[model samples]
Target chain A: MKEKLCSLQEAVATYVHDGDVVAIGGVGRNRAPMALVREVIRQGKKNLHIVGREKGMEFDMLIGAGCVKKVSFALVSLEEFGLAMNFRRKAQAGEIELDEHACNSVITSLRAASMGLPFLPLRGMFGSGVFEVSKNLKEIECPFTGERLAAVRAIKPNVTLIHAHQADKYGNVRIMGSPFEDILKAWAAEKTIVTVEEIIDNDEIRNNPQLTSIPYIYIDAVVHQPKGAWPASCDSYYDSDIEEIKAYAQAIKSPEGFQEYLEQRVLSRRD
Target chain B: MAEYTTAELMAVCLAREISDGDRVLQGLYSPLPMMACLLAKRFHAPNMTYFNTADVIDPEPKKVPFSTAGPALQERAVTYIPLWQTFDLAQRGELDLIFLGAAQVDKHGNTNLSAIGPYEKPKVRLPGGAASAHLCAIMDTVIWIPRHNNRVLVEKVDFITGQGYLSGGDAREKAGIPKGGPRKVVTNLCIMDFEPETKAMRLVSLHPGVSLEQVKEATGFELIIPSEVKETEPPSPEELEFMREIDPKGVRELEFH
Candidate 1:
């Protein structure tokens, strides 16, 4: 049994390497592993490929920090607040490659990887132009039905980071509500790092084994960091820091503003 | 004549479209549709199953949260679904009605939530298509646009996220899509539905104070208008009170603003 427990800084330093395709788990402002994401930015890791379903704060921060080179996911907006300014600006500036997929397609790729399959067939991308752009997606005929369907190649990330409500000493991770691709992402990645708001007793995890979203067998590292999903809602813990997200959305509108934001918020926060 | 904001009116009109025991789906950042789902449950469709994009299935939250992913929305959810399951159900054709918003909607009802310009060099990189491509291919889609204008309602979308009728007739079926497609498009100004013959979006009814001329001007392409277009009825006092009760914080006002 490997001792999976560690600090957020150590976990990011050890597992997340440069140019690694890292998947951060969350939907919108929910359960985003922002602490580890900020540490990744602070470490100056470059050319990282990021994957998420509905990426918001984590991806946007990484993109703004110039840490990400490519992104494969659907819809990177702040939901209601507006578009992800950094992601939008950097993507448009050609600074980063945007391999956009339907939200389902992103999950399909993850699900394929998790299932240990070469590719997964789906009918979702049949008519959409996504098939035309996505190099990994090809149109193939179903053997039985002979119907044309989209076959997406498995996307196995080098490492994945997920935020959860609690985890035990042995890293049985439990997410309070709406796992939101974290479990699937963990299963799909080569290495999975979990950041938790609290680290409970192993006995507590054992008593309710079914409640555990990710078992210790899958999780590589468990980082105990309270408010790990700061600014993003942590479900049953605290509400999203909307004012900060809103300010970040507003300030990231310009190059200078974005720079100031990165310096003041991400870079300066050594704690 | 009663006074109600366009958001409330849209909610009321959308609620009317949902029937009893119909399973409804709403996407992220959809406050109006979320309200409509709640209203339908309270009034006509109590047995209806409602699911939000955030994976909150049959949520019975006290107040509608700012985002579907918010904690409030998950206050008393029947179950939690992953993003994968949401699409899985759609593919299996389990979901009946879906409420979606689009950046641009075409005459044929094809939607664009992808980008404003070409894929390579976009003038505006709008949020890329989520599950709209799949949901639109399978289930009955109800599009609600808070802002109605020529730019929003185009002759042809820059890109098709959710396939409406494609090129009309059996185009969707020809593309190997499932039976259902865009059923209605409720906007601030009017409610539009696809013509049975051509699948072109037709002006079904104008909102109160919204003229047919105004709708035509706002629409990018020529619309199929009935000779006798009726005005959308204002939300009744009871309906308004129910809505206000459902949303005490006036969160719906944010969308209109």
Candidate 2:
């Protein structure tokens, strides 16, 4: 018999662990798993490390909820209107240990891990400041040309929390918008969990097999949550709510404002 | 000749330089030239390929910033391919165009994105470099430096985030990269190309609103502006409307980071 599927809270609860690196999918205010983020807040997750790639809203929510202990990312902005106030304050205050990695390096490391590779050859540090932090890169001589190149270590995640446009009961999912670095993260993670806008039939997926990006076997659990990818646009499904994003940006800057904001939308009103 | 906006200046570069049907790869946040390349594909050559860092290849790429037609973009007729496999395409010399941005671009086309003014404690920290460094050596890359001030176009970048013109294709070969160095450099004020023999940069054309003095003064190094600078074209009525209508939800503003 198939196991019982649960709510967004239960789904995220089952996977997250303290001090674990989790990759979140969404950009600024679009397609982030806000419902589950609320659950993280409710649980009061501690020592959680977040890996963000254009995942502004979810990161802010977790920080607002005091969930993340450390963060590694490229850019953490609230999509255009302004700064990720709460996140910025936390980082500046040394509340969270922040390791600012380059966007391509993070994704490349994840991509290498996803492919089950030990490391990847990288050359993104040519004319930039990112080259400094990456001095740890190991150099090896290439067999083909004998030219030495640096290898960036792989990035493996403890868990992957992805929001998709559609998914099947079997766990195959469709990412309706920009994949960002989601595919690479899926490979790098030990376990993958997803919140999807809709659940479709496996037969439907089989009928049109190519559309699926997240293969079924990799998924540990799939939660059917509508509007799950909020803040981030899900193609034609929905446009991002700008007012909500602005409110989030404002709320994150101040603890009182953020707590009040979260209490009003997420904690006070039940999902 | 009419005065051209920055968008048109970028478009003129692409239309004039990119061959009739060369595969072009552009990364995200590469706005000005990306818009230009897409416009070229729509108007000049349909066979031209378009690839986004998100990994969609030649997608009937949605005009909207966040693509709505994700599934349709991967359909058979679209020649949808793996995004990471793009490196392979460049390795095999299948790419002709690649659009990139630089925080600080020097006379040699070297780019910097490490620190602001100083090495450790800088005035402003910028987002570190992306694949521009790697891609710079692979494809017929085009560098876009939107801010055309001396600080941005310097005599030498503070750090080499991406190489501009390799000593030559010989340096690229020694490095095991099959392709060559950057073919052109696109800026807000003027367009530039390398002096092949010495690998020095030479000015190709200046944007309409920009003057010879402004272009020369803005550059960190002495430039060889052509005797006759052609005016850049203006955005079509359609292009202007599209820029406004889509992603009105602060899509443009969300790019501060």
* Top-scoring candidate (TM-score): 1
- Give every candidate's TM-score on chain A: 0.97, 0.91
RMSD of each: 1.3, 4.6
Tens digit per residue, CA lDDT, model 2, A177-238? 66655666776899888888889888888998889887876787888888776655564587
Report how far residue B221 has shifted in candidate 2, in Å. 4.4
lDDT of 2 by residue, B172-231 (tens): 455444455677887767778877666677887766667888888888788755566666
lDDT of 1 at B257: 77
- Model 2 regions more than 4 Å off: A1-4, A26-34, A52-56, A59-104, A122-132, A176-181, A201-212, A242-271, B1-4, B60-63, B66-82, B117-122, B165-178, B197-200, B220-257
RMSD of 1: 1.3
Give Cα distance to truth, residue B143, candidate 1, Å: 0.8
- Please give the TM-score for the first chain of candidate 2: 0.91
Interface RMSD of each: 1.5, 5.0
- Give all TM-scores, in the order shown: 0.97, 0.80
- Which DockQ-derived CAPRI band holds candidate 2? incorrect
lDDT per residue for candidate 1 within B1-257, as digits (tens), equals 55788889999999988999898887777888888988898888899988886687888888777877788887788888876787787788777898888999999988888788987888888877777766777779899999899999999898887788988888887888857889999999999998898999998899988888899999999999888888888888888989898798887777787
Interface RMSD of predicted model 2: 5.0
Model 2 lDDT at residue B60: 46
